[model samples]
Target: MAATSSLFSLSFAPSRRRSIPLSRSANPSSAPSDLSSKPQLIELEFLGPKAGGDGSSPVDRVTAISGEKLLRNIMLENKIELYAAYGKVMNCGGRGSCGTCIVEIIDGKELLNERTNTELRYLKKKPESWRLACQTIVGNKENSGKVVVQRMPQWKK
Candidate 1:
């Protein structure tokens, strides 16, 4: 039984190694073509309030695949600061209920999905530019463009 098991293992080992090289060779050739045909990347620029509280802040640029994620998720993934000190402690964790994840859309509004019902109720009196990041979807996955977002509005800070 031992001898038979060892023979079986040895026979399969060489075949497994041979298959690995064939799969690796095939994948590299196909990967580039697939990437080229995929949709263009969406660029996001997050602007934090100026330290002086008087002018534009420096831009933190990030990119994502269109329509793949929410604004809050993208900001968190990139380590961009999206909440005020109070909001950090009280945010609803992307459920669109707490309204702590609000941001201003400075540009590329068309790339995002329309305001959700939660946003409409929460921001009824707020500017049209103000959006709840947790409710904002970045793109339609088909459109690609630059979106500028102002993180943590000054009033909140």
Candidate 2:
């Protein structure tokens, strides 16, 4: 008991600590500006039930701030419901684990980054159009165009 007490009483600290320097950001906000001369916009078409299981429209189009990341812009930061199942913790949290965040790339494939290994593995069983919303970045090298996307196609409601 005395040895245990002594161990608890001992002060443990790092021998030397290194202070990391912080880099200055061009923008005050957390979001960085796209390289395009004009602000890039991600155009999303939220596909609803075509046969009308719910009152939602067959397709709902929305234009939002030009965020380069798809999951961060749409799922995390915005109210746009890209999937029937949504999660930050329960799902992969944009790491491309859970396939719940899959969306169909109707157009603007060039606008996105590339298919992550996670998406490529998970989507092997699915169609080529299917992509994990979290893995898909909105803008690409040439950011002058709009990134068009269609929400999950299997969404009945």
Best by lDDT: 1
lDDT of the structure predicted as candidate 1: 0.89
TM-score for predicted model 2 compared with the true structure: 0.60
Candidate 2 segments exceeding 4 Å error: 1-36, 49-57, 64-67, 85-89
For residues 1-157, write the lDDT of model 2, one tens digit per residue. Answer: 9987776655332212324433434445633543334555767666543545555556656665454556445654656666564443366556667777877777777767778898989899888877888787776534645555566666644
Candidate 1 lDDT by residue in tens digits, 79-145: 9998888999999999988999989999999999999999999999999999999999999988999
Q: What is the Å distance of residue 67 in model 1 from its true position?
A: 0.5
Q: Name the top TM-score candidate.
A: 1
Residue 90 shift from truth in candidate 2, angstroms: 3.9
